[model samples]
Target: MSIKGAIKGLLATLASGCLAAAVGGIVVYAHGFSALASLRDGPLPPVQQTRLFADLAAALDGLGVILALLIVLVAGGSMAWVFLAGRFIAGPLAALRQALGDHAASLGVHLPREEAEDPWTPEGLGTTLRGLLELVASREADLVASEAHLAAVIDAIPVGILAVESTGYIRSDNLAARLLFGQTDPLVGKNLSALIAPPVHPGIPGRGKDTALDMVTRAAQTHETLAVHCWRDPSLFPADVTARTVSRGGSLTTVVTVHETTERRRAEAERAHHRALVSAALEASTDGFLVVDLDGVVISWNRRYYDLLGLDSDVVPRLPQAQRYERVRAVMADPDAFHALYDRLVNDPATTVVETMHLAGGRRLDVFTGPFRVDGVVAGRLWTERDITERERVQADMARAKEEAENALAELKETQAHLVEAEKMASLGQLVAGIAHEINTPIGIAVTAASHIADEARELAVAVKANLLRRSTFESFLETVHDSATVLLSNVRRAAELIQSFKQVAVDQTSDERRLFDLATYTQEVLLSLGPSLRKAPQRVEVDIPPDLMLDSYPGAMARVLANLVLNALMHAFPGLPAAGTRDDTPDAPREAVGFPGCLYLSARSLDDERVEMRVADNGVGMTAEVRRRAFDPFFTTRRGQGGSGLGLHIVYNLVTRTLGGRIEIDSAPGQGTCFVLTLPRRAPEVPVAAPSQCDASGTLGGDSTV
Candidate 1:
């Protein structure tokens, strides 16, 4: 307990002790009187009385002793109770003092929640103390937060802030100051001159403390600050510094703000470099270029613009756009047209226009006007002007040359057509010769058989005149006559059949006849008619067709197509191999062999959907890509001087497409051989125009096939 409370308790204990002593004395006195009275009023004789009195005295003594003991007990109990109360109160009071001292030292920081409560203190007093400590703790926390926020704000500032004393010592500096100075150590107490070098340009004075302070003081009067350039080593940073003096607490403090200008200066240099590059590009351009804003305000123009317009170069861009247009209009052939186009372009932001302008000096100009977009939105209009006088002249010349070339090509096709007809007539003559040769043998045999029969008849007449004829001779003569008659009839019929076959082929080639006929039978007849030429060449001619396939198409056209294809293959394929009759059937022989063993021509027909597909292929010398492309072109032949008129395939192309409603394609390469595939409808088309799908190569039909 506190000393005051302890002393008060001691005094109260003494007073209680005195009260107890007084009460004890009173009780003893009363008890003693009662005992004495009992002795005085004795009921015995003098000697008995004396003995009784002694006994009574002893009883009274006993009573007195009992009274004394009671007094002692009361005093001792009062003292002991006060001492125990003092000890219990002192323990808590001491603990409370120590706790309060610790809390005060820490400015009321929190302590362990497990500490015992001070029983000596009252509840209200403890509550009041706790509230006060909490208030102090909250204020302390807020103070710490505020300090941290202020420090962060200062650190985030871009410019360096330095507060220096007039004595040249750095009193305080923010984070920016240390960063700008490239110093990580504490800046306080360091001399200001030691951190930064002197200003390079002397015009910016007040770098030293004395001069800076003088300037700062003068600036205070003028309400302006002095600026200087300071550079520091190790980081070679150039900073712009401004200083002003402030009077605080009766001392002069200079507050300097430093701003680094390196990045700004670098950005300015890059901008200048880009401007130079743009200027060079504009000057080097051949076309006239002009840039105008959305308001028709001319922003810039290159030198070529004046040169192209034949205007004076002295005109400046600052002139209004109207004045510039008027100057340009003086040389325009139609000024109103230019004005109308300009207005249209300005109103419709998305439209770009290109026009040719005929100028006063006969110079042609190609002018283009379009929107100049920046970031996907139209900002202005850009005009580019190019002179096209020479280009027009060259184009006119090329047109004339192309017309001449076309005329020459037409004449050449006419000549080739005649040659192709001549070739067909020559082929016909050869067929006639072969037929004549075949018929001559049969006619000669028939003539010899008839002559023999006449001789036998004459000999029998001689025998009858001589009268030496026998019945056996007559019978033999009859038998001989029967054999001769039979032989004569057979030979004559064979000759007539040969004549009929040749006649049918020749008539069909000259005339187009559409009739229902078996394709296999007709194809066989056509190939058989070409037996003479096929026999001369060491080549295999295969006819693959279904026997029952029938078509109501122009058989004449088909006959011509097959004949022309066979002719082309024989003449172009196996160029150096001599005519060696029919080829041997050797399936394993290489197709590319240069000898006579490899010459093969395949003519196969198959029925496609509602049409017939015929393929004429050869394992002979094939064409290159260029040749195959122009293979069906009129008068286009690789063998110009060697009897190749180039119209063979062309005629075949026409017959397949124009006569019969079909498409034809030629697939050929240098050494791999050539194939001509023709697809015809079941019935011939009435219209005499070529089918749109016909072509000599891969998917393109480049020419007309009309009669």
Candidate 2:
């Protein structure tokens, strides 16, 4: 039962006991008085009556005194009961009211002042206590839910999180912390120093050796986030740890947080490596390289840059942009131009400029300037300079040499022309001598016949004058005259034919005129003209050309080509044979005695409507492979000092290929007679007639050559 209810029952019990005692006392006194009155009235005299009355009066006084005593005792007992109730019940009730008010105040609820100050009542006190208890229960539920949410949020964080106490014990840890440590067991209650190591410090004993507990204590005291290294079994990684002190129920606790930095550290290492590589490349370059930012500040430069400008390396990097520019301009031949170029490059960052720079010390440099970009955005400019003084000097020397070579070539060509003209005149002179010798034979026969006829005629005239001539004698004279006349006419006609052939051959050999001529007819004429030289040689000539084959080409060049081939064969084809115009001592000498009776073969045929093929071959000791390879080379010969000009076949090759628009090839081997095959166009290319002295050895006289 409640204290107030128990006290109420006790007060009621006391009141009932007092009332019962009062009734009992009244009954006892009245009963006693009645008995005394009955004894006095039954007998007696006046003396007995007076005595009884006095006794009755005395009894009444005593009864009244007893009743008064009873009243005093009862009143005193009630006063004592009231004092006990105030001391035990009302005092405790007042203390209970004060406690309830304080709890309400703590929960931010105010209680009315009258409620605390009023006299204690069980019912009022019970109602107030029940209302305060219900409000406390509601607030407790909200606090539990808030704590659960905060724990979930901390666990969901990706960074490793650890809440450690000041004594290094792990009070709380998240999934990230467990994963980072590579652990599956609970981390709580474990010493933080056992899970993670401190940062390493070389060369300093005991430095950076602080345990996790010590670090946490220090961090809490200083209110700072400390960076440290943590161990995950085999390797150590970077981490940031922070600690704060919190008070819970009058006790101090520290909350510590840890964050890993492995990726960030790796990225920083990679960037450092790349920077080292770029620095090495720049230093290795031979050219001067410099980089400047958009604000005209020097960002970087290689050693070559300072070396090229003759500037102090240690001082240049510390100088301002304007001062650096001024120092460089001092070494330039044109300071104004250098300043202008710098301004232009800074203003137009996207443009690439290349130009030459002249130094005051007579040095030339090739300079290139372009944008330097970072992350695809133009942030600065780059300059590259290379020395080119030696290159320019070499180029000037080469130009002068080229001019001198051209002048020498022109003089050589003129000399070659003179030699070619002289050679042509020598061949013509030979042709004239041969024709004169042929004409002399025919003329001698004609003269002999005329002399015989003159003798016969004189004899006939003498007989007629004497008038004594017989008929037989006159008839003999007439027959003799007719025979002489026939002999004279035939010889004179032979001489005239020889003169005409000589005239045509000479003209054709000296001029480069184009004409249409039959192949067979021209070949025969050329061979006839070379008769003097051919007859003197031991070799014989052969011809096999189509009579109807025609060509509209340079006949003069053709004749010269034919003559050179025939003469070359006669001179070189037959060895171990007597020289020209000389004979063996033995009249009956076998053909083998003259070194294999050589024969020169000349053949031609029409290849197509616009082309022809010609062959000049010999059946004598042929040329070797080495000799034939260089047969068309200028000034090459086997008989260099034996009256062989070596130009005989060379001239022939040039004339056929260049002047006549043909190709000539040599086919020969030792002891297997040589053959020169020529393929020519029927209508030669139209070109200016080159003079004999103007033979083009380089084959540039005509458009193109196939030799």
Candidate 3:
């Protein structure tokens, strides 16, 4: 039973307890007092008459005196209890009744309180309560059903769900709601207004104005359904509250549903930010990209695409997307297949490329169309186009120039071959010149000797015939002719030796021999070949080649590489200081170095029998850091024309890096001359060996050489 019931039963027992005591006192007094006679001077009569007369008299006095007092006392006491029970009864039960009555009165909602205070009285509000209690007792089934319906609704809510009456009464709240509010039960039937803490600001609503109070209040007043959100418990979480105000039988109430939105809102914000980032990235792209739907709607086109197609966005937005796309379609190089292309783009399951689209301003675009998917289903096309017109122009220009270059290169190659031939000729010419010089001396000597021998013979014959005597003199003449004859023969043999040496040098220079040879001898053969060009300047030739150095290499290639480097230095570096446009700089030396005579040195050492490292260096002007940066760029030559082919170094670079499996490096400065170091590896480095082995010229080898 409720505490109220137990307390009420105790009060009823106490109030009745006093009445039972008063009645017992009255009963005991009547029995004891009635027996005593109050007639003090009375005489006895006959036995039967006296007994009857005496009993009658005693009864009358007892009745008038003590008996009467006892009777009156008992009656008065019983009457008082009957009257005082209503007033002296314990108040808690009555209070409960008042509470229950208020609760029932505001069953579906809170009610506007009456202005007057209720002076509780047994005859008035008490009578009304008793009748209601009797009715509840009479209809237990209906009351139970009402209670269960309310309880069931309260149990179902996972989140905090609450209902409040318009008068600020707590109508109902679920277990979660009570726990969230940190309370045990609803303040059932408590005056909602009395229980509510006053608003933070007087006359103006604060938390009170929030849904918990406001919607209930407003609905009660206006009889409208009001929905709102509020935080019921600030400590646990900011509750996403949805409140719906309602009215029932002139009573107002509001139901509140509180949901937690922390995770969901966070996820939504993150996705939104990612989408913004993607859009920004697309807009910032340099490539032209656009999207089209299966229905031919122009969805998104990057700014570059707009510019590429020469489209005005302001004009495009006014037209239907289909019309705008029609305008865009006109720019497709293959517009005839645009519709088909679009269909394919939307339908294709894999990536593919579409080529050469025409555009405004005589430009060509490269269109890359891909499928746009929505919900895992292909929806439309995402086309990315680039203006490849410039690339085409570059290709065309390169093709023509390449044709001219090839012809020129062929001619140059022919010239180089001829120069090689001329080199052979120069070798032969050196031989011829040497043979001529040596043979002229011998031939002159032989002719003079022969003439002298004839003279001597003639003299001997003349002397013998004229004199006809002197035998000693005739013998002396024969000896003189014999000596002169010996001298002539010796000179002829010397001429033959000179001719033989010339013939040998001429033959070896052109012979493609793979056999190991003396470095000094091969280098001399190369020098002999270079004699034709050297003779022009008549420059003094220095030969420092060691005779014992041996290597097995393509002598022809070695000869050619050396020739190119030497000729390049001679023709390019000190060509009169660039005719005043690029006068050579004699810059200061580096702060720390071996010495100040910035120079290029040529030397060779035998790495092995299979390899020889020939280093060619010069003392002319050198190259700077900037020059080295673009030094290897294809078709990017510092020497514009000058018959450079630009490919001179490029070809050299390729030959060393690709054809020969070697490295070509250039080290130079403003004043310090350039050194082209060719590291030829007979036993090539461990790399993937293709027929034409490619090398990375950019790879730094050993020590920094200030290249």
Candidate 4:
């Protein structure tokens, strides 16, 4: 497509056309001239008699036509040759132009051209043109992609975005920005808050009319960015937002990140409430607690901890950069003790210690120390100091009481021995009748043995005196005397054994060893202990104990309960016949002999799988309902006088209910026998000592149990 190539093609065509025309003209002229010469010289073609004018004109016209025909043929051949030459050259020139264009492009500089830069030339210019078209197309694609990315990023963020021009005109606003400002006009080219718009909330950005416009104007004038926080105060609760002016391609634009702080505010309030609860608990708690850092810096101290030691923030020592503080140093004494413990745990990583600290002011604390782990790594140490001072004091008192208790036990044993002796003496006085009654049989047996012995001895003497008896007869008579004497000794020993068993029955019942005793055995034993009062009953006292009945109970307490009830029967149930004449006597014994029939009954049964209930009912003048209500009360008794200690039923109630964790009920009416029904569990119950009781309370037993 270059001018040189076109000119060459034209020239070649012209040259070819000229050469062909010249050849054709020469050949045609040569052939015609030759024919003319041949005709003039040899024989001229006869001119026909074809009308003088027509013939002359025709001959001339014929000469002209032949010449014309010759010219036409030459022109036609030249045109064809020119056309062929053009056709042959045009395709090559075009291809050659293209190659030259590609080659020039590879060189990076435009190649020198002579044809004044042909339009269709195959040179660097064509490559430059193609490159320009591709560049323009790529720019269009990039512009589209950038717009898409900007839109995506802006919409994804919660904060509204905007771009502003130097003239304070809004260039663009994202969806969020438009919503916040209550403008739906795309906000572009609009002066923010300057033009007519809706009313603004207090917290809305640029709240006052023209305020935002003035701010933007000032910013443009000053060429500075602005940052501000605002809220939409449509409601009492406001939505707060932070707006920042950021530079975008040399222009300042506003971007806001919105936040609704209601939830965070509520959570903070809840945390405050929890902190208040902790503070209150610390204030009210009896245990002293402290929260500290790893270095034992006191972060928090509760009321008890401060109150007990007379220390508070006012009195607490403040010493910075010290290995240990004044208070802790004074308390610990050893400068490196805390560090030693800290190192012990830090080094081994699995050590803990419970230490007993004897602090100042004669106080004590059980301090437990351990490592604190944050994210499964040791970050600090936590120390819990319990004011076990009370427990220690109690333990000390208990030890002292134990020693005193041992002494008391010894004294009680001695006193009981003496009481036993007194009772034995009283018993001997009472048992004199029974002993005498029983001895009559032993005495008769002894007397009969003695008589038999005398006879035997006399026979032995006669045999010896005769001096004529054989050895066998003398041996037989001596054996008879020896056997009689043995019978008399045996009778005396039997009587002594009965007295001893009766005497020991009361003391032996208090032993710790328990036995499967037939109720009969225990009843008889208690009766023998109370042998002195048997004759007080006018009628025979009836005992109805099933032969096979057994029970589980502390027989010592049971025996005592039986004895007390029986003693009550003797003293209160029946009125003494004063000398069989007067209604009253001058004085009464601890146990008075009754003038009426009185009976004592003791029974037991397996109330359930794990327990037995024992009963002791006495056919004595029973108590009224009012008295029954307070029957177990210490020092409350129907028999106010006659040595009633009044602790019998009270002790029985405690032993059964507290010790056995069982219940005791009393059913009694005036003039009827009182029945003490005990429903006892066969297991022990664990419970702390109870609180002390107030005096004069109704239906109370014994002293308050230990708490």
Q: What TM-score goes with each of the models?
A: 0.54, 0.69, 0.53, 0.48
Q: How accurate is candidate 4 locally (lDDT)?
A: 0.53
Question: Which candidate, 1 or 3, would have the higher lDDT against the true structure?
Answer: 1
What is the C-alpha lDDT profile of model 3 across 1-707, one tens digit per residue? Answer: 33345334534533222111122121121122233233222322336333533453454443342100101112111210111222334354454445444544543322223335242433333244334444443454566787899788777767776677665666767777666555677645544333233344244344554534654454455655333323233433333455566777777577655555556667878999998888789878878877767675777766787777878855763578668768878876667677676566546645566777775458988878777689988777777878788899999999999999988866755554554355445445655565565578789999999999888778777876888647787777778778888899999898776566445545544453345556567666555555555555412334445667765544544555565566566555554432222322232221112122222234666676566676666555666787665565434446676655443454455445554467777777776667677777654443223322112244332211110
Give RMSD to native, each candidate.
20.9, 18.3, 14.9, 20.3
Instruction: State, as a TM-score between 0 and 1, how close model 1 is to the true structure.
Output: 0.54
**True-vs-predicted CA distance for residue 45, candidate 3, Å:** 54
Alpha-carbon shift of residue 286 in model 3 (angstroms): 3.5
Against the reference, the lDDT scores of all candidates come to: 0.65, 0.68, 0.53, 0.53
Residue-pair clashes per prediction, in order, are 1, 1, 6, 7
Query: What is the RMSD of candidate 1?
Result: 20.9
Residue 476 of model 1, lDDT score: 95
Model 1 lDDT per residue over 133-190, tens place? 4555566578789989998898899888888888878888889888787778767997
Per-residue lDDT of model 4, residues 584-636, tens digit only: 22111112322334445556677677776666666556788788777766556
- Sum up the clashes in candidate 1: 1
- Model 2, backbone clash pairs (residues 3+ apart or across chains), number: 1
Better of 2 and 4 by TM-score: 2
